[model samples]
Target chain A: MLRLPPFQYHRPSQVEEAVELLDRYPGDAMPVAGGTDLIPNMKHRLFTPGHLVALKGISHLHGIRVQGEELTIGACASLTSVAQSREVRTHFPALAEAAGQVAGPQLRNAGTLGGNLCLDTRCTYYNQTEFWRRALGYCLKKDGTVCHVTRVGRKCVAAHSADTPPVLMTLGAQVELVGPSGSRVLPVREFFVADGVWNSRREPDEIVTRVRVPLQPKAFHGSEASGEVSTRVRTGYAKLRQRGAIDFPLLTVAVAVALAPDGTVTWVRGVVTGLGARPRELTGWEEIAVGEPLTPEVVEALAERAGQQCRPLENMIQDPGWRGAMVPVYVRRALGKAVKQGGGGSL
Target chain B: MAPTHRIVRLTVNGDTRTAGVPVHYTLLETLRYAMGLTGSKQGCDKGDCGACTVLLNGEPRLSCITPVWEAEGLDVVTVEGLAGPDGALHPLQDEFDLHGAAQCGFCTPGILCSAAGLLARNPRPTREEIREALSGNLCRCTGYTKIYEAVEAAAARLGSGDAERERGERKEGVS
Candidate 1:
């Protein structure tokens, strides 16, 4: 049995109290939401906080609501709830599908949206038993000073393995966080940093309150036969992993496209993860997709460019060459899915 | 400094119970070690394996990763709670026995808990729904054919109220 190191547990009914508790302990305290990811890492001896401020007790952090044109999801909302939410499934199907695909049934029931977004970056060299990591003299992300992935650089290249952040970025979501300094909001795209040692920009004492995403149009349509056009927003997400269930993503692609009434692309954005410390929005997509209609040929061109720009590293367990080879295929598929979402989930 | 332990109280299998547990001990450890409710097995201490699955507030959750204090004040139903108070097997359990669905029986407890949860929400689930519900629980034996068949039969029996009739019949015979 891998026993968790002892810690004092504090259940705070209010978000302010939780932040104060964490601020008092500084580096010695950590806020735990679902404990799905943190518990396993603690068992591996990755972290040993003296205090764990439980966030589930906070009443204000547990609902899904729509405020005007935006949808707000409490940080403490369970992943299963997020996946099954009628509002989420209707307006933001990509987010729901990604949340539903995380891990398995039991985990989705326990894990939360904030926890998934704040998931720790993963690496093959790390995430091992204390005994196993000890045998290798440790790595740069932990006790030792060397990075086994590069075998030379001091920077850690652990891959970001979460599925929802990439999709959230495509939706232009904003993250709400409360800390000792008071509350602040930032775009989800800016929440993460490139450094893998500790990827997110969240402060040590910060508590993620909720995520707010502007609602998207329900449909997008273009008919070459009738020469009819309609303006809409469409998004799609696709993930590559070892299994259909209970496996972290090896590669994930998310895309969102807005079309003009004339059937020409107004704007397009694409993000891919499971390659580096931060999920990256592919550059030069606007150049290729802005003026042209999202025909199969145009989609293939955008995919080919993305393939050339993405260089996979040996951060995840899969072969970098294979993962790199899969980038274009997954990206193309994701774009194709987005183009077909003119009606709804069935599309 | 000494470790902090709390006196946690919770309802398990329709009974209220209390115990002093360390803050770090998981619900799985507290259930099996402290309370001696060993029906919930601990296969992978982490969330990967479904051997430690149990129902918290009527939803299936991984007990191995859940903190013991988190289950406080919530109704917890383990595999032992699946049968009636009089020891009449649940339709799922009776079917498993009749069909020889359990092989090695290691994963049976978790599978039963998950199946019970599915039936509670969705009385008549299709085979695809059954497969999706049990995806977390890994059954190495029987290739899942017997398990699927048993769950289907249990659903049919439950829908028909056959198990209730059998229980009433047995009570009358005993009297």
Candidate 2:
């Protein structure tokens, strides 16, 4: 029986009009497309905007197009469409995999990539019903001033729960954002901020219009022979959750790596989500595995190093210590699966 | 403040109907209360339970959290609409009966719609894909082995040309 608080709903026919509506309402309004995330949050009284600018009426924000070497996915494109898209599956399999693994099939059918990318940071303390929150004296994510995750901190410490950002970051994606100042494209990695109070760097008036990703070689090699020339960079996603479906990830790890002709790792990029305030890319890990031949010992060592660097707090569904322990396990598993899939020529 | 009402037009179960619904009313409420299409159950209104699943523009979506206004101009197909114009059961519904997929019957409508959407897109999905597609829809009564079998049977029946052809072959006893 959860219900959205009363509000004025406006359907804008264009992105410019949507931006103008947001600009007009300022802090009392929010834009909604899929409403997969926002509606539920609103019912729980997490956010009570007086006005909601519906974005589904914008025709230009509903299609996927490829221009030259890059693919532009409209912000209003549903997660199901994005995951099942031939172009997305063919060109950006990691993104597709990430999308496919979000909440579940039902949510994916209605939720949009824009909604997922712009997903509000989540915390167990912040996601409860208003009654539960009031009973708990309200955390800093909503009404209070002190962070429950870091008791002394003045800001909220909600974890970034989006599953798509890590994979997008691994692929070097860019997002088009429109605001009163006009449109600008920034690296997807730069869109998120580590601070929980303000999880995104985009202005309140800004609307993410499109996500453009440059095409890259397919990571899965279709050959069975263990030849070096046929070896391609491998990408994989591994999520840790209490249940196999429907629940958000307790911790997620995405790994993309390039191997040299002799099987030595050339480059490695590791991204972790559902752990901290935002998804973080581990840059120094390349040096740890670049020269090594990805043996059991080497993978374990690199995984341990990555796990040691993650500072998981008691903000998500699982225990902080258990989630921290799982970092290495998931990291190793994702990298191992990617390496195996790359070498074995299977998706 | 008291809730304000808005008039919404919805095409549900092959008929067009209009109702003055509160802004907070979801598509689930509109279907169950306004149009009397109560086949779509409300298990977990939070979208965790897929009992409120229905087709919005031919794609399966959670109707519980979906606002009624979002369905203003869309074709909405509910579990009640799965029957033919003559009111015959859908092949999936028939297969559910044949395979004993319905236990409590509370979760059947949602699972049926989810499977229908899957078979519409992929006529022959692998077992893993089937599991993944129906992961959102939960069934607490049957162990889900029977439900999966019913979907596979429905897919085979639907993908093999015509229903009459399958029925005639079944009558011919070709196993």
Candidate 3:
């Protein structure tokens, strides 16, 4: 019977009111969208905010609409809704798959897209009961000064376990937020910092309003010919967890590749998470993939380079070596899924 | 500062109820302690376990992580609401008994809510759909074979009523 510490709850019908409520109690108040992640962390005593500004009552923050060349998802839109959305499923299938595969059906029904994107980084030593954490003297992510994972590094290395952020990174999404000062938008990749503790760049008083994703990813090499090029774009996501359901991913891979009519790759990107604080967008993928047909051999080389760049740590319970080994495997699988979905597999 | 506690008004199991509770109390806690709806069990007070599942606006939601205030003016159907007004057991419940779906019966209530929500949306669901719907609700004792069997039987029994209703509508249209 773990009990939440007592707090004042404020339900604001408008974004302005919600941000004001949070601003009034800066550092003592937190904005809660779905509470799926925050409540558990609160019960674990990781955060004991004196006030919770409820964002569910804000009407404007609850729909998924398309605004000409981009899809806008309100922050309060439930993950279940996002996963089942026809528009999201058709355009950004990887985002839908990631959202649908979070925790379980019930949690998805309660969790929100903004909440998932703002999910607290998780680690084996951090997500524990107060009594258990006390026995271990706590960790760097919470109240303690020392990091149990690295045991030496000054930086906290908690793993980012959220499913959608990596996929959103691949999609080139942007997050909209309203704070006491004003509203601002940030690229989803730039939204997260390297630090695991309070990972996102969102201020304490800011309320995430919506997320905007371009219908078509911008050209990586910026070499688009005029009208009749007949470009085909595809994306895919792969996740590794202990169970088929209700488990946070040990390793997640998301890839998006665009090809010209001749099967020559124009733009390609891959992002992997559950490794460190921020989702790591795989570098050197463009070198292997761009300007060439995404043949099986090329995909294998891209995956191999990803394997060399990623190094899984002891932040999670699984063996780091096993997780590292699976990175290339999952990356290759994701590439295969994307190629198949695009109807352009050269395998 | 906002009020720490307030009276929350909501409809539960076809009855309108109001209770004064602390603002931080989760829907699971308010339902069990203040409203006396203990049928919705609280396992893994976080969202991991589906023991506190309830139908909110006819959709299965995790009440354990949901704030009580968010349930305001919404229809909440718990396991206690599964039985008919005449106190007849739901077909799902009867099937659970006919099949051995309940060993300890700890996870039955949440499973029932999830299955009920699934049936409301889809009268006839495939085994894969059933498995996906109940994936959140864990039953360690049953190993899920008997539970799946029970849901399948219940869906069949309920599907006949749906057929009758459709026929009645069609006949009315003809008239």
Candidate 4:
């Protein structure tokens, strides 16, 4: 039986108190909301915090409310609640799909969006129990400085395994964080760094309060003569896994495309996760898709270009080569689905 | 390291009680050892196996990872609570027996609680939804075909239309 090493558990009722607790404990304290991820990792000795500051007691971090043109979701909202939310399903269907695909129903019921977003970067070498890790001579992620996956690399090359970040990035979301200093909002893309050792930009004393997403426009009314143009956005996500259920994605792609009235692509954002140290937004894809109708051939070419952009190392559950090879397939499928959903392609 | 003793107060099977539990003990251990409600099996003390699943505040949560302190002031429903106050089995339990859903019976308690939570939320769920809802709860025996059938039958019996009318007729004939 796996057991968490003895520690002090503190349940703070508000975000400020939680932040203070985190500040007080510094490197020895970690905040946990759902414990779906943290508890298991604790049992495996992946994390050995002297204090566990729980965020579940903070009632303020629990609901979803939509203001005029923005939707705010509390960080502590359970994945099940987010997945089943009417507002989320209508405006951010990609996020809903991603939430529904995480772990399974049981985990979703207990797991929080904050936990998923702040999920520990995972690697086959790093995820093993302490006994197994000791047997394998501790990789760069935990006790050692050398990354087993890449013997030449000086830093840990663990893959970011969260399913929500790519979808959130495609939707243009911002996260609200609170600390002793005050509150600040940053675009979700800015919250993550490419290094696995320090994935999030958040300070140890900051608590993620809520996530804000701009509401989709009411109608697809085209640009007027006055030059006010409403962007026609289409988005889709595709995840590659060993099975259809209960496993994390080996590789996932999120695509959002804005199409012009003439059926040419106006803006494109492609985000890929579960392959590298962090989620990456593939740049220079708009140049590939602009002025051309989204066709199978065009999608294949773009996917090939996107696949070439990724440098997947051997730190994943599947073979790194297979994971890299599958990038184009998933990218093409995601782009094709997005184009179809956006109503930008010829029937 | 030795176990630190703590008093944990929990409402189990519709009753509130306090028991002395180890600080490191999980809600699963508290229920099975402290309270003697062994119906919730301890398969894979990790949360992956659903054998220790129970409803905390009417939601299906993995109890094995849940700390005993976490269960304080919460309503916990386990397989032993599926019967009525008079000890009659729930309709779902009856359906499981009727449909021969329990072969080894090791996974039945968890499956029952998961289904109960599902039916509580959506009285009438599609076959696919049922499969998806229970995907986390594993059943190594019976190949899951019979269990799925049992959940469907239970849903019909609990759902508000033809099955309710049929159950009413059965009650009248028995009286």
- Which residue segments of model 3 deviate by more than 4 Å? A219-229, A343-347, B1-4, B162-175
Worst-scoring 10-residue span by lDDT in model 4 chain A:
A219-228
- List where candidate 1 sits over 4 angstroms from the true fold: A216-230, A343-347, B1-3, B165-175
Candidate 4: segments with Cα more than 4 A from true spot: A216-228, A340-347, B1-3, B160-175
- Residue A102 of model 2 has an lDDT of 87
Residues A83-139 of candidate 2: C-alpha lDDT, one tens digit per residue: 889988775566777888888889998888888888988998898899999988898
Candidates, DockQ: 0.68, 0.53, 0.60, 0.46
Local lDDT at A298 for model 2: 78
Better of 1 and 3 by lDDT: 3
- In Å, residue B11's CA in model 1 sits off its true spot by 0.6
Judged by DockQ cut-offs, is candidate 1 incorrect, acceptable, medium or high? medium
Candidate 2 ranges beyond 4 A from true positions: A216-233, A341-347, B1-3, B160-175
How far does residue B46 in candidate 2 sit from its true spot (Å)? 1.9
TM-score (all chains, Cα) for each model: 0.94, 0.90, 0.95, 0.91
- Tens-place lDDT digits, model 4, residues B8-124: 899998899789976767888899889999999888776787888899988988888786777788899999998878766787887787778999999899999999999989988
C-alpha RMSD over true interface residues, each candidate: 1.2, 2.0, 1.3, 2.3
lDDT of each: 0.87, 0.82, 0.88, 0.82
Model 3 chain B: weakest 10-residue lDDT segment is B162-171
Q: Write the per-residue lDDT of candidate 3 for residues B1-175, one digit (tens) a residue.
A: 5677888898999999999998789899999999999999989888887888999998998898888888887999999999878777788887787777899998999999999999999999999999999999988897999999989988997887742233334335534
Name the top TM-score candidate: 3
Per residue, candidate 1 scores C-alpha lDDT tens digits across B90-146 of 989978877789989989999999999999999999999999898888877878889
Clash number by candidate, in order: 0, 0, 0, 0
Model 1 C-alpha lDDT per residue in residues A103-169, reported as the tens digit of each score: 9899999899999889999999888888999999999998889999999988999999999999889
